[model samples]
Target: MQNASHRIRVYQASDCPELTRLDVSKLGRAYHKIPKIISTKFDSIEARLGIFFLKKYRLNALLSNLTFDIDYHCKNAQIFSTPYGSIGFDINRKFLLSILHTYYGLSKEGNTVSLDLTQSVTKTEDRLKIKLGQELLQLTMVKEVLNETLELKNDYTSIIHQWPYSVRFWLEGYDEYCFSILLDAHHVDLLLATSRVDSESDEPKAKNLSSEQIEHMFNNMPLTLTGRLVSINLTVAQLLNIGPGDIIPVSLNEPLPVFIENEQIFSSVVAEERGRLYLSEFNDKTPEMKYE
Candidate 1:
């Protein structure tokens, strides 16, 4: 299931004694000193999704019946700035990726979500709505919907996947852009294969796309053996430290020492004539593999 548990907060009069003793400013200022704040931070998703939910099922109070959860929002969300970036949520609160130069953190350019539209997300959406029914109902009852389609920092597409299509939207060009959305809080728990936030070498782009696009590329791409290890990179400092002509030794000394991940594959020797490399006798057992 979606795993969205509803929280029924029936507001009763606060303890007058406690209120009189505690300073409102100390409690971060009194919000809803009246009774309660229903659903303010993010507009209750009822209006946009209410009719569909109500007709598809039951009934409830008017649209305005839903109230904003003022306290939770005012407290949980904050004004944040980092070397990565800066963001502010003037209204409800949005998040962003602070890709600050020289800062130690994940860059906004990397770490993106791929939308597999080929996989249907209707099931996921339904489960999410069901699990977080109150939230959806709140939206409907309040005649408001969460702004799901905020500006995607990177390229993005909308598709229905297996279910619980959750993603952390990292906004760069925009402020208060970082936030997460998916089927249910649970599905995000069982995430399948995940790409690194930063694929230092080669990484695919597209925060979203449909099934056909994913499938089309998945099927057409050549299955290049990933075990191939072409080079080992070292910093300039390591090279400059070499005195005279120090022999920087490597592990495998086989003639065909090409490494597929760890295992040794086609073996070749380093032959430099005009500052270029030539591999000879690659995987050659009987004969020496030579370069052209």
Candidate 2:
């Protein structure tokens, strides 16, 4: 690779414009769009579905990183029996959460509610719609399911390449809380690429053509040499037992995760001065950034 950077050029256009289903053309046909509404509660949906159980997000991130103009649905989330015990996973996030939309249709509007500094205002289904572009943003999180080889990027990519499938979704057209993974893949890809400069010959590109002056632009970021986030989240009971002593659990250790688009590009340490929080930075420059 040029300057020890991964220069990516591949792109993926999802099978259907309607993201309620998996494009099983790559991952195989065994996967299908089977959405099941929790119907119970929305609190920590990803926790119940299990995201902290995921071992890694590299391949999933790569699959997602390469494309931007499609829709994917995280339809079926389940736990499977394995020798290692019950393994649960979203199994479809590569197509869903990875491909996001900047714009969407907003349904029910929300009213402003007042809150107190010390008042406990939590675990509420704040059913509010925020207009994006062609689609509306709904409650979303990276869900997980039981899996064995999830840590291996290639095995995952191989399975995804051969049998790409979509999930069953309850889209946002009619309802707001109901979810789907509809996205402007083209736009997403364009933006992700814009974050990186491929080569010295790379054209003057970017949505605003002002990467040269972006305030957030950095020559490098911390590298995620080796790490993972595991089982986490506090139950209401755990949150309710507050009158006495308590300890909240977290999957992240010293170095928390960093990403351009939630892609887990690095692990960083958090610091604070008086009250405000800060993150320690390191070097992990992508190709385009190097040329710049």
Residues 1-292, model 2: lDDT tens digits: 5677678876567743534444422232212222222221234443332232132212111011112112333323222222222222232222232222111212114433332335332222111111111111122312221111322111111111111222223322223222233222222232223333333236655557466555445544324343343446678986778675566556555566556654656666766777755567643533344553
Winning model by lDDT: 1
Query: Candidate 1 on 117-161: residue-level lDDT in tens?
Result: 354434434333233333332232112222222221211132222
Error of 1 at 142 (Å): 26
Q: Which ten residues in a row have the lowest lDDT in candidate 2?
A: 59-68
